[model samples]
Target: MTTPVTIVGAGLGGLVLSRVLHLHGIPSTVYEAESSPSARTQGGLLDIRDYNGQPALETAGLTEEFRKLILEGRQAMRLLDRDGNVLLDVPDDGTGGNPEVERGELRQMLLDSL
Candidate 1:
């Protein structure tokens, strides 16, 4: 038998891959460089696209929980010129392909799912 799949780094991609594999009855061990979960700041924000990241999370069985964490109307994208003039500002109409969520919160959600 093969040794358990070893995953390095507890970042989004790594954690997502590990989670998906585990869903299919594959065993894995995530080797994070940080001493613990809060060893470093997770980052700013994340937008889970319905095509890739969201689907992967769905396959891993965390959609409903993820939905609870979705930050609606966070897609307020603004395009500004170098002179600090707001060229264009788009409000969140709930039609965006990506939904923004706090990085730390999203990571915690994934961790909890696992």
Candidate 2:
């Protein structure tokens, strides 16, 4: 008999793992402290890139869905001083592998996939 996979915390990592496992016909149970997705604020944006995050999404077969969530021009770099002065600003040339998307949206997409 195969041992079941139990993933703690329904955050990005756990959710991705669950989705990937599901795609490969593996079963996994995810445990999250929150009562529901809206129980707490999902918080902030995420930068998914070719090197790290994007690869994981691809493994889970979410590349197309992930692309739909990409927020253009979010990879632009900006450096700020203590006084809120902009030291450097660089626009996203569209080649910067990383693209930003809302964390909640990504989480929801993974959930829906499962």
Candidate 3:
């Protein structure tokens, strides 16, 4: 008898789990409360770290695809005072440990991969 794997949510982790399971010929189902993938904005940007996120993407065989989605300069950070005075500003030098990518793009890519 084969027991099926059940996962909740269609977020990045859930989608990645499902994709990996499928890759190894495992049967699984993902239950997302959202009516659809686009029910709402995926929101903001995400900084996927090389030490952490890169390994996961490699494990999922999505390293190349993920690399293509990296958005340059998104990792830059800026701080301002209430009066809009610049307190501090740091620009992405393209050598940061983590690269920023649009949240929606990452979600869509994962969904598409699945």
Candidate 4:
């Protein structure tokens, strides 16, 4: 029999590890400091780079789900002056290779996949 793995924290890394292990027919337990998934607010935005985060999610077999959490047009950037003049405007052409996703939403998606 294969021994189960113990993971600390239910953050992105821990959760991904657990999912990957589970896919390989292994079991793991994740321990988190929070009492529950919604115990606290998880606010923040992350750019899941194609070369980094995207590959990790693919390895965990969650690429499709991860893509669904991406916020459309978030890759665009704009700069305004005091006079409200647009100094720079970069539209999201969908080729930035780094899409944005809400931290909370991503966490929830990962949790649901487990």
TM for every model, in the order presented, reads 0.81, 0.84, 0.81, 0.88
TM-score (C-alpha, index-matched) for candidate 4: 0.88
Q: Residue by residue across 37-69, what tens digits does model 3's lDDT show? A: 889999998989999887887888898899899
* RMSD of each predicted structure: 2.7, 2.8, 2.9, 1.7
Between prediction 1 and prediction 4, the one with superior lDDT is 4
> What's the C-alpha lDDT at position 30 in model 3?
97
- Model 3, runs deviating above 4 Å: 76-93
In candidate 3, position 94 carries an lDDT of 85
Q: Pull out the clashing pairs in model 4.
A: none
Each prediction's total of clashing residue pairs, residues at least 3 apart in sequence or on different chains, is 0, 0, 0, 0
Backbone clashes, candidate 4 = 0
- Give residue 13's lDDT in candidate 2 (0 to 100): 96
Q: Best candidate, TM-score-wise? A: 4
Tell me the lDDT of candidate 1: 0.85
Candidate 2, residues 22-77: lDDT per residue as tens digits?
Answer: 88888899999899998988989988878999999999999999999999888888
TM-score of the candidate numbered 2? Answer: 0.84
Q: Which stretches of candidate 2 lie over 4 Å from their true place?
A: 77-90
